[model samples]
Target: MNALPRREAPWAPTALRELRRPWKLATFALGLGWLLYGALNYGIADWDVGISLLMGGLTYLLASWSVGRLAQLRRPDAIGLAVALAALFAAWYCVDGVYVLYHGLAGNRMDREGNFRASLLLYFLAGMIWFYRGGLAELRRDLIRLIPRT
Candidate 1:
């Protein structure tokens, strides 16, 4: 009887990994480009704007580094399935962020919030996708089975 999730193609690069180098760079560029545009057009005239942009860019880079780490772990990864994983991450991040920063986010800084959210949303999504498709779930499933099932 199969008691645990089977590990298939355990060391394959996931779809998110395949897109990692490209997506990370893309998000970084996209975020920074918007930051620059806002500064020039509107004005980096506020601390929140700068802070938000910095966080967004940093997260995208962090997300990219994660993909490399997963490969080092020799995890199995996938692509089409990765999209679902990405969306899951994005949803989680957004919800968590709103929950934690609800007070601050209630202010009238939708522009900065929008810019940063776009970058962070993409970064979180990609990283989670990589983890999900890159054998992360396998590790999780195995761990879950360690518990006594009623």
Candidate 2:
């Protein structure tokens, strides 16, 4: 009689096991980069900028937590969580960018014009990249489950 292969149960990975998931690590790094860039370019005195920063920090925390939960039973919902957070951040940036552009058109300080646009672009790019990575990871996991073992 042939022996059947053991099935691996899905459970959140311990801190020691997290390193094995490269996608999670990459997501964390991307979040940190966004946080740092936003901090350096914008002063927190403005309420709009302050709120955006706060949300960015919170999003990073959630992404970190999700990394720990990666091994848990296929939570396709994690991707949705990450995407929602990213969309929120992007919307915030878009609103701020429009406000800044309006002021600039009115002949206000044009010094930070380029910086503002660059920051908005960077945030958008980061969000998209994270979303894409999460999607691909989910798809890969699904594919793995579909393959039959000999």
Candidate 3:
């Protein structure tokens, strides 16, 4: 029996291939932005910087995994998944904000160090999520190219 010709996915365009190379750079910039925000807002506390670095590393890992999964799945709806992830991130931020407000109402000091630390972490998470969205957008564009036009 003759072997079937290997199908090259039409959506895997060279432009998309080039885009993947910049993801790491984008991630790095995101990490740096988080660090700068923390330094500016919190005055470079040791623990805050350490936690921000740790969170940035975690964000990078999550973004890498999501990108890999998107590449493996040729479906044109990866953008939906990206949007869902973004929503989840925002929800978490809102919950955290409410918690902080509750603590403030409970008579916690307004200038508590912990609150500033938490804000640093939140800023880091926000920057990382923004970068992740950028990467997802590129992936979505590639997936869109895969759909066969009628």
- Top of the candidates by lDDT: 1
Q: State which candidate, 2 or 3, has the greater lDDT.
A: 3
Q: Write the per-residue lDDT of candidate 3 for residues 6-73, one digit (tens) a residue.
A: 22221335323433556555756765586668746866434244444544544443333333333344
Q: Where is model 1 poorest over a 10-residue stretch in terms of lDDT?
A: 1-10
User: Scored by CA lDDT, what does every candidate get?
Assistant: 0.46, 0.45, 0.45
Ranking by TM-score: 3, 2, 1
1-150 per-residue lDDT for model 2 (tens digits)? 112112211123332243335774566566656656665675543324444454454343333333223323244476545644554554554535544554556555433455456545654444333332234467578668989999
lDDT of 1: 0.46
Clashing residue pairs in candidate 2, if any?
A: none
Better of 1 and 3 by lDDT: 1
Q: State how far residue 85 of model 1 sits from its true place (Å).
A: 18
TM-score of each: 0.30, 0.30, 0.31
Residue 78 CA error for candidate 2 (Å)? 27
Candidate 3 Cα deviation (angstroms), residue 15: 19
